[model samples]
Target: MNAKTRRLVAASLVAVTATAVLAGCGSADRGGSGAQGGVLKLWTHNAGNAAEYDVVEKVVNDFNASQTTYKVEIEAFPQGAYNDAVVASSSSKKLPCILDVDGPNVPNWAWGGYLAPLELKGGEVPLDDQLPSTVGKYRDEVYAFGFYDVALTMFARKSVLDEHGIRVPTPDRPWTRAEFSAALADLKAGGKFEYPLEMGTGGSGEWWPYAYSPQLQSFGGDLVDRSSYKTAEGALNGPTARDWAKWFRSLVTDGYMAQKSGSSPNDDFLNGKSAIEWDGSWDAAKNVEKLGDDLLILPPVDFGQGPKIGGASWQWAMSSNCAQPEGARAFLEFTRKTAYFLEFAKATGTIPATDAAAAKIPGYEPGGRYEPLVRAARDFAVVRPVTPAYPYIASVFEKTAKDIVAGADPDAALDEAVKQIDANLKLNDFYAD
Candidate 1:
């Protein structure tokens, strides 16, 4: 089944299960005395990620030890289930004092009255020093900030590219649309691998928008127009968007990539089953382990608007219902230290949030092995739209894109997507105040 069907099924299951689970939870009393020498509850979507959880625990421990006024108590949830849990919590008015939010969800949560504005004092972490994509802003106010962000790029082995006579692309001089297409065609003509590229079509959920929307943007199309933050109309279904759709579907039709690639594209690339893999920085360590000096981390193709990649990862935020905003803000400020950012990036193998933090990380600094990722995040990253309707917009795009790939007419699919997105925006009154 396609991703849209899977998502619908998952949503049905979550809806059926959430009611029973949330029934016993107590409502969050927003009127209580603010963290009066008491524990401030925190939530994280790192239940199974030991390395990341370990760093989080260390930060919490340090924060508690350094303060006598309030202590932090944390609850961990698996990433897949965390959003459902948060939604249930919000419905029951039982959100924690502080929580880690996925970047795109910030606007949704904040708009739903679940997240409060994160007020960081001046000189906290030099927000300007961080990549633009790492800061989550809604309605012109900062709602969340992440410790690290990931960049998307094409992964290949130098030997394979050299053997195929394909020109390696760099951040400064990435392959244009025609050049990229020709390269892929040449690589496929060799017929050594099943396909020349693995676009990670097998992955679902946010991966669809995170990986593919940038390509759309590069084609002068967008999920929605940022000018008004109100509609997907011409931006999504325009002539340029149709061009992006046709080119995207052609990747499969021309046999340059699989309609449904292997379960693990990175592994396929490492195992020599594919020549190039479009993926994120999270796979860098494992790819390096397998390919060693043969690894070639190439930039995303410049479709038209000069190469673009989706940005923003997990970010920390304060709950709007938290009575202890001061305590929550204190923890946020405490964790903003460059040292902690370095630690998190090291533990998570993600690009650090700030230049200072990046400088501290070994492979992310200037001339380091993974500096290409840093440059990509710095030069090409574009955060998903900051509107509250992003969730609906993303779903619409995913379904439309999947249909377009599955032989549905691009114009019709995009028109339907734009209609749905516009309807959603209207239902929420454009999420106006």
Candidate 2:
């Protein structure tokens, strides 16, 4: 779809889905489950991803086999359509007993009463060992748990950086802002590659905020002030944020990176068109296969505050209207096995949610290759703001960031964003409980 179409659809979804989740919830019958001692339905967004789907399917099948009193069923949708499907299901009160949602949206969903606090029976899956990003929480209660998470990191060929005299950075000592700029400048001046950096800029939707807002945070600005989660105000439109905007645009205008990277930044980097690529752990396996020992999965640049990256991917939750909350919780707890975490991490090329799961995977073991990504996630990862206003905030940030990257005045764009965000928060009474 074109940019305009995508924006329109996203906005419409935000409105329609928000209404569906808030209005007339708890009015649906059965929520697609048995009234008592009956089958429990589970929905997932992994139908299009066979590996993850298989892992989910196995978990469901195993749960069904393990208990005679309750049998869990699976219905899957493509990731792109899953949210819309849930919204429609919710409007009709056909939501499954359990459903998986994006981690960042858990707060919104829970706040809208679409999800219930995950009460795992028998403590089947202890959450203490899992990464903080894998446990989705709001109002001091966990609403969702995820299998794995992806870390945002920089990638380059060790040989190329070595030849360029660029020092490979570590989690403890990442490239400072000046050093990163100098490295990019050197790569651009070398002229071996036209775009010294490929940042997957052609992507849209959550990618814009999820991939870039952390850079803004590293510059000592956040999507919103976490202290109250009330307004963007000085947070998004502040001086540090403006610096982030100007520096980001400079990456494109100064010719260090593509304004719109090719459809695949990883491919561009692999093909030698880009010296360095900023991407997720999902793409690291491919680069490793191609570059072998020369592949460098380096830490993000420390833009003053510290290196930061977005966290929280997809997570599973129990529907608030589930007819059998106990059964739903049991099913959710069943899926949190260490084996499943390992399977998911291996299949999806993401970091394991728990250290035990990480130990099971090669290169994910401590002090091994790719462990820096795990460290980055554990150290520098920041979950998006926890509030019902987040979806709107994310959309605003996306638009403002895009405009700024396209040469719009950062201050003006950011001020407009803050105005809209404040208006929204006030409209919702600060999403009061």
Candidate 1 residues 1-433, lDDT tens each? 3333323332332233554435323432232223435678888889899999999999999999997988887778777667776777664456788889899888777777778898888445877778888888888899989999999999988898888888889898999999989888889888897688899998887899999999999999999988998899999999889999999999989988888877778888888888889999999989998889999999999988989999999999998878778888888988888888888999999999898999888888899999999999999999999877787788788888888888898888999999998987776667765
lDDT of 2 by residue, 249-278 (tens): 999899987777788678888989898899
Give each prediction's root-mean-square deviation over alpha carbons: 4.7, 5.0
Error of 1 at 274 (Å): 0.7
In order, candidate lDDTs are: 0.83, 0.83
